[model samples]
Target: MTDKAKQYLELFLVFFKLGAFTFGGGYAMIPLIRNEVVSKRNWVEDEEFMEMLALAQSAPGPISLNTALFIGNKRMGFKGGLVSGIALIIPSFVIILIIAMFLVKFKENAVVERVFKGIRPAVVALIAAPLYMLGKSANVNKKNIWIPIVVVALVAFLSVSPIYIIIGSIVLGLLHFLYIKKIHKR
Candidate 1:
């Protein structure tokens, strides 16, 4: 195969490993993905990963699939995205199929029940860790900091739908851009 093809294959393999090991879902995979793709391989930079994550969130489908597609495309091209997306999904699909069969066959097993119980808290912690990291990485300052707080309050207090949250964030982001533009003009 060509160098580009090799790169795409590597992307697929890495993500396949990630998909196989990750118990939870997209949120739990973020930190592990970052560690492997960003820190270990240097395939993507931290800022690029964050930006890609934002794009992935706005796009359709699962975040992990989107993430693999984004990074793979960034590295190799369209072919990379196709290969990586397929690779990331295949393991999860197979695992799920196996688990479904096993669950049907052994629904009453105490061992299986206890294993799932043990995994729940670890999955929660894994999800929480990335949230903490993302918060720490955010460029918080007096001017723009309140935007998140307000958005959170509106969501929590008013029970706003997530679509509204996306709309609100977009408007706020544009306003922040304008504010900075005005500051630069002055």
Candidate 2:
């Protein structure tokens, strides 16, 4: 295979594994994805991953799939995106199909329930791992710590829509930029 073809294959395999093995959806996969894409593949640096992750989180879709598209596009353009997306979906699609077929049989199985119960704590850890890592990566300091805490409270306690949160953040960011520019010009 040509270098480009090899790269595409690698993208397919990597994303396929991520999709297949990751149990708690995209957020839970962040740590593993970071390790593979940043630490192992050297495809992007930590800062770039944080940026892509921000963009991915903002967009509608699984963060993992969106991230895969970004990495694949960075490496090989449109074809890369297509390859990565399809590869990522295949395992999920197949697994879902198999589950749907067998779900009735396993619906009340004690062993299956116990297995899922056992995985819950691990999944929570997986989801929480990225929060600490991303917070450090994003340079979240004591000064800004209240921002995330407030957002979480709004979402969790007030039941505010995330769409509004996104819009509000955009406005705040623009205002901050303008303030910085004004200060710079003075």
Clashing pairs in 2: none
The C-alpha stretches of model 1 lying farther than 4 A from their native spots are 1-8, 23-64, 100-133, 140-149, 183-186
- TM-score of model 2 vs. true structure: 0.65
**For each candidate, how many residue pairs have backbone atoms clashing (under 3 Å)?**
0, 0
lDDT at position 15, candidate 2 = 92
lDDT of 2 by residue, 119-174 (tens): 99998897777798889987899999988999999998999999899889889999
C-alpha TM-score for every candidate? 0.60, 0.65
Tell me the lDDT of model 1 at 183.
Answer: 100
* lDDT of model 2, residue 157: 97
lDDT for position 161 in model 1: 84
